[model samples]
Target: MNQIIIFDFDGTLADTLDAVVRITNRLSGEFGYLPTNPETLSQIQNLSSWQIIQQSGISLFKLPFLLKRVISELNQDLQLIHLFPTIPEIIQQLQKKNYTLYIITSNSKINVITILSRYNLVNSFKNVYSGISLFGKHKIINQLLNQENIEPQQVIYIGDETRDINAAKQAKIKSIAVSWGYNSAEILLQHHPDALIAHPSELIAVIEQIKNPIG
Candidate 1:
């Protein structure tokens, strides 16, 4: 089997943070929360995923319904969204190298696939595990290892959040945190990922070094 590369959808692969903010503000009236402004968003970006949610003033009991509505909203907006810079080319390069790509996202599967299709990237990834809970990515990571009969050493989890680093740690897989995602680089660094990459162009070299480190 090809070496696997698992990705997080929202902030990692798809540049949906801005869209999320817009949607969140739009839903604030119906959901009865304050609109998140850029200043608030900047502060939220320093916190972990779960922490951000807690700060949202949405109780855990109602989070599922809120997420349902958010996912539905995102479904309609996915195509309008874009990937991080140079991501499409990088993914194509990875595909050419025969890496088995998989996506684990809190977003709906249809939403993930829809946007990939827009970029002519639907076939670049082998599978997408969608609708993962905010704090439950480790469980899905474990499930992916089991379901795919994959060895942990042959896999790397690449994502943009502190929670992704935590999940990779829990799953005992190497993690690379991209600086351009949901959390600031400083905050993500505090979480201690195996590596921190600053750009899409740096990814291949970093992965190669990780896979075949020089003595």
Candidate 2:
């Protein structure tokens, strides 16, 4: 059975949470957004991205600029970003099982490719769709499906945020929310992803279940 697994790069594939927090905090003063304290971090992890943007006092107009700066800062710190535990092995296993993989991300393509190249995992994904709009990932997912000639039913978009789940839904595909990423389990559960996985190792089992829903 051939399947396509599209992934969100930042929190889903690479553990860039701490670095993002640091960058956002460092720029908070300049951007007029509230800096994330420990409490604020916990609070926002459970909130959707839009909610966070609202609470942080950042206008939608400034989000793109802010994100661009953040991504640029993140680029400078790419050496600090890395795959979550067991991701390499999981990717290998999925490849062995013949799952075609790709990445769709708001992060820059260079950033995604640089990290994959670091781990010698560049060949794992057939292609990458990067630098997507912060709120327009559904369009990218649809484009990827059309470009790849894959049906929504045969594809699953996996990510760590409620927006990702929403995008997958908007694109008419299944979503598996990962708890080990940006969103908390409780928050992700509320989004009602088709499957919610807690660890990288749990991915294979969930994919298998998606492949065979009755079994």
Candidate 3:
């Protein structure tokens, strides 16, 4: 069977936590809420803006305005987006192996495209799926499975958070959780992903193992 590999953009392919923290805290200040510290912000890195607000005790009445403002600001700050270390090499290796690659992200389409283009990695992916709504990984994954004619057993989803693992499970695809992203090893391990990778290089070995597993 042919293999397809899908990746989550923000925390998995790019180091976006710094940008997320900056934007979240800026929005919190704008909404008259206490600014979140880096440590606190790190813990909620996997959540969407609405989810973060709810988890952080922000009132529902202020959420809509705050979310809109934050998203607008983030869109304007695209210059700050960056690819994670060694990601280009990883993409090159996967391409060399003839692995079908795609990106399934919660980020808006424009932002995902712009960032990938900026990093010159846009051509590495055969397709990019961006979710219109927050926390839309599951929906995107389902779409890819049906629209792209990819079977669950022939695909692997690589991501940073427990939510990504759950999304892959919901889509019936194998999942690999990366420890170097937003969520720690402990949090990702709780989801019991098919594998866990600590560095970009380890991903190649994981994919090889998946392609040739022992009975």
Candidate 4:
């Protein structure tokens, strides 16, 4: 079966947490947002993006500009970003199996592409859809579905955040929550993703199970 697999870039594919924290702390003074401490980092990992924004003291009115600056700073430190262990192999194998891959992310496309290209994994995804909005990813998913003329059942979105699972549910599509990203496995499970993956290799099995269920 031809499956449309949508992935989230930041926590899902690229390990940007530490780097993001460093950048955020470096810019917190200038942006008027609170600098994240070690404890706050762990706590924020469990919170949704919106919750994190509120806790960080960033005004909603300034979020777009903040996002743009965040992206700009992140791009400068692209050397620190990398795909999680075994991710390149998993993605390559999925591509070899003829799965249609796409990435919908809040991170900038330039940053995503730079990392993918660095690791020679740029060709794995068929499309890279990016946005800065902390909400409304479901709308982006819907737009992708319409653009490709595909139904919800034919696609599965994989991410490491609560928002990702929520967006998938809102779009009425299956979601695979990855444990290796921002949100903890426990938190991700609470969102009731169709599948929860602890490692990259589990992705192959989940896709197979989704495509060919046995009685």
Candidate 5:
């Protein structure tokens, strides 16, 4: 069976921190949360998503509604979003190597497709699963594993957040945390993912190492 690589979209593939921070601040007033400033934004990178949520004072009960609104708002400016430098080539190289790639994200399917299409990456992935709950990625990951009849050891989840690492752990799969996203390298290291990659091209070596460990 072909090995599967599950990816988180927002920070892992797309450089969405600027867009997300802008959108969140714009919607903060109506959502009844404190807005983040440039300094606060830097601090947020040091914290996990859940920790940032707690600091923002946003009610947990209001997340689904807020998430829906954020997605709708972000979709309007799909042109403003972009993938990180070298990400497209990295993805293409991985696909060329016959790896089965999949993306699981909390963003809307429409938005993800729009961005992927913009970068000519729409067909690179075997599947793109979106609209995942903020804290429910583990469930989605587990479902994919069972649906594909793939073993946890045969899969690796690459993401840029602490929650992603935790979810991968819960699903019993290896986690590769990337630093060029919402979470800083220091914060990601604290989460203790199986591998920590700082550049897009490094992914190739990491995957190879996982598939064939030094013995």
Candidate 6:
């Protein structure tokens, strides 16, 4: 069977920190709360928006209103969103190797599609699963495994958070932690993923190593 690679969209595939921080702090100011400092915000980059709100002690009642406003602003800024440097080349190389790729994200499907389209990467992925239920990645991975008849051993999951590592473990698939994304290297290292990649180009080598283990 062909090997499969699944990616986390926001922090792993796209460099969306600037837009996320800008909108988050803007909403914080509007709600009369002090904005999170860049250093602190950087640490939580892997967290979903709702997770951020919960961790920040924002009242649940106000969260819906604030999130709606922030998302509205983000939608308009999609065109300006930046892709991680070398990501396009990396994807191209992976595609050339006939690797089946997919995206699993907490983001809405519309947003994910839009971003992928903007980068001309819409056709690269075989499918996408997004806006899933809270803590949905493990479930999604299970479904993908069943539907595609893919063995856990033949799959690799790449993501930027501790939760992602946990989810991959729950699904019994190999996991790769990306240091260039949301969580710090220390935080991700605590999860002890199958591999940790600090650069986009490193992914190709990691996948190759996994597929062809040395004696």
Winner by TM-score = 2
- In the range 30-127, model 6's lDDT, one tens digit per residue, is 67555778777775664653466567887766765665666667777788776789998898889999999988876666777888887798899998
Ranking by lDDT: 2, 5, 1, 4, 3, 6
Worst lDDT 10-window in candidate 6: 43-52
TM-score of 6: 0.85
Backbone N/Cα/C clashes per model = 0, 0, 0, 0, 0, 0
* Candidate topping lDDT: 2
Write the residue-wise lDDT of candidate 3 on 50-125 in tens digits.
4565777777677656656655666887888888878988898899889999998766667777888876888989
Q: Ten-residue segment with the worst summed lDDT in candidate 3? A: 44-53
Give the worst 10-residue stretch by lDDT in candidate 2: 130-139
Q: List the candidate numbers ranked by TM-score, top first.
A: 2, 5, 1, 4, 3, 6
lDDT of 4 by residue, 86-142 (tens): 899999899899999999998888889989997788888888988887788999899
**Quality of model 3 by C-alpha lDDT:** 0.81
Tens digits of per-residue lDDT for model 2 on 57-153?
Answer: 8878888999999989999999999998889888888899999999999999999999999788889999999764878999999889899899999
Residue pairs in clash, model 5: none
> For residue 171, what is the lDDT in candidate 3?
87
Alpha-carbon lDDT, every model? 0.88, 0.90, 0.81, 0.88, 0.90, 0.80
- Candidate 1 ranges with C-alpha deviation above 4 Å: none
Candidate 5 lDDT at 198 equals 92
